[model samples]
Target: MKNIFIINGHQKYPFSEGKLNSSLIEKAEKFFNNKGFSVKKTTMEDNYDINEEIEKFKWADVVFFQTPLNWMGVSWSFKKYIDEVFSMGMMGEMSDGDGRSKEAPKKNYGLGGKLNGKYMMSVTANAPKEAFNNPNETFFNGISEDDLLKPMHLNFKWFGFETMPTFMAYDVMKNPEIESDFKRFEEHLTTNFK
Candidate 1:
């Protein structure tokens, strides 16, 4: 990717100070820069202009999202951001807006993505990775961790961006192996981009 856009989706709250996400963002910025990719980033804490955020998407070849799972889903701020930004009609104009004519409301429901070939990758930090592996687990019954991000993948696909395999850091709050996780994440960036 020649130009990459990174969104740090962690919300600053009383429970978390957003340190891990910030560190990951810093590492990613430096790593990509060293490899000569033009990188741009924004944190949820920033004062963003709607137009500029859209412009960034237009300029990027790939987008990387960093987030923490709040209540098993993305934070409220990130969801709000998506709602506001994507509603501006970045997902192309179908013949009938959502590719559905009034006569056939169910025909082409979700095929209006504008950026056809651009890609996205998500890196999430959350509870223990093993929590979702057991058959008796409430979160996921032996499903891969990537499944937790299915909604996000579909959302990005709606905008026409191809999805990349996600990177994750588990047990972040309880007992994060920061050093090991960073190594693995660095390796992921290297292998995926190369």
Candidate 2:
């Protein structure tokens, strides 16, 4: 059976209640459980043990992240989680982790990845999808997803995770379309993991 880890990267703000990501996490848990996969979850709103999180990453076959786009970046809570957890010497556990040492040159920077067979996928809620495709829009150079998610892609790659196709919701604040978005999310999960 596949082991799956899901992270709800939502943070409560004055205007945003973080309900969308909460619902998504619930849906994912139910879906993965019904599929007979071994599922693990982390809700960013809760207090987490850093070592446990690292262990979860090591144990899972795949990791799924559901996040909201805040000012073109992940929420501060989620970012802090990453910064703290990854900084706890997890990268050293990846491969040799001493690529900069004299024994291993910096040229082999990406060779030290422990979770080589693992995979990751992210679903982010942001502005309308049309804004990304419009050439006249200067917000993201017509590649909003890539523009916003490149850092995450590279970080996951450095950790030896093959990336799955990303899923996104557009115009969340103005018009949520929650039901349709959930349907597409289900489709995405089924299609990618099946």
Q: Residue 114 of candidate 1: its Cα lDDT?
A: 69
Candidate 2: list runs displaced more than 4 Å: 98-104
Q: Candidate 1: which stretches are off by over 4 Å?
A: 90-96, 102-104
Q: What would you estimate as the lDDT of candidate 2?
A: 0.78
Tell me the TM-score of each prediction against the true structure.
0.90, 0.91
Best by lDDT: 2
Q: Write the per-residue lDDT of candidate 1 for residues 41-98, one digit (tens) a residue.
A: 8778878877788878877888888888887778889888887776765444311245
Over 1-194, each residue of candidate 2 has an lDDT whose tens digit, in order, gives 38998998888988899888888888888988999999988989999998888888888788888888888878899899988876663456544463456764657775556785455545556588877866788777677676677877776776677888888877888877888998998998889878
Top-TM-score candidate index: 2
| lDDT of every predicted structure (CA atoms) | 0.77, 0.78
Q: Against the hidden true structure, what lDDT does model 1 obtain?
A: 0.77
| RMSD value for candidate 2 | 1.9
